[model samples]
Target chain A: GIQVEQSPPDLILQEGANSTLRCNFSDSVNNLQWFHQNPWGQLINLFYIPSGTKQNGRLSATTVATERYSLLYISSSQTTDSGVYFCAGTLQGAQKLVFGQGTRLTINP
Target chain B: EAGVVQSPRYKIIEKKQPVAFWCNPISGHNTLYWYLQNLGQGPELLIRYENEEAVDDSQLPKDRFSAERLKGVDSTLKIQPAELGDSAVYLCASSPGGGADTQYFGPGTRLTVL
Candidate 1:
């Protein structure tokens, strides 16, 4: 079983500020994903980055599989981005995906 | 295409009562999963189904929690005589295939046992 830990469990920033969240896994993983859980509790898929880096608008994620870590970046954050961001990964040769506790972001307008 | 669908977005019941939650995975998805999330924690896998067969359920409390996916497309999770400790959010997810495929989740069913 792979354990996932997230850094900066809580973050508060003014709207338009930027932030970075990190996730570290205990072991090698075959796949990784980022999700944003909105205030309504809907887990919206952000990215499926098993490795390398990807960007979508103001959000981007980079995964260093060799280092067993991932980073998510948010630029020009908006008040709507106030929620929990989670990173989950599937351990090597395992189908189960383990998730980090989450990074709670609060963007004040 | 619609994402995972779950019914009864919220449920509130007295302790020792029975409750059930339903889930309909995305069409053509072969892997369906049920996860439980306690407040301020990550979602934990309760059961994993490869179609109609439950390949992984070691984490499920078989004594009181039971789940079924009759046609391999829709699933139902039931808690018989539920306890206060069972109060949490139950999420349903699905992937195109098993093993490392990206999983999509539903809004989840929030249950509160009084």
Candidate 2:
């Protein structure tokens, strides 16, 4: 089984700030995704970047498959951005994904 | 397109009681997955179904946990004689069945055991 580790287990930021969360995997992965679990416990799909980069509004993510790592950026963060961010990965031919602990982000007004 | 659907959204039961959670995946999806998420932690895969057949369930606690994806669309996860440690949020996700296909998740069901 592959291991996934997320950096900065917990983060606190004031509104309008910026931050970066990172995820590192132990091996190459065929699938990689970043998910935001809101306070209400809904997992929202943020990105499906197995490789390359993608951006959605104030959120951006980049995955370097060869290096087995991914980075997520939040710029000009808002109060709504407070949640737990998780990075999940699955290796080729594997049916299940391994998840990192998560980065708990708290954005204050 | 609707995302995954899970019910009853929350549950509470005493130890040794039997409980079940249901999930309906996104339309046209061929892969459904069940995951368990503890407080302040990421989800861990419990089982994965590839259209009526479970291809991965190694992580499931077979002693008290059972899951089925009947007809390949709806899934049910059951825990008989549940214990306190079984309390967690159960999440359901669906994918289009590809190597890197995007997975859509539903609002998980929070279970509490007393």
Best candidate (score: DockQ):
1
Per-prediction DockQ: 0.80, 0.74
Candidate 1 chain B lowest-lDDT run of ten: B95-104
Clashing pairs in 1: none
lDDT tens digits, residue span A1-109, model 1: 7889999999999999999999999988878999999989999889999999999999999999999999999999999999999999987777888889999999999
TM-score of chain A of each: 0.98, 0.97
- The interface RMSD values of the models, given in order, are 0.9, 1.5
Model 2: residues >4 Å from true position, as ranges? B98-100
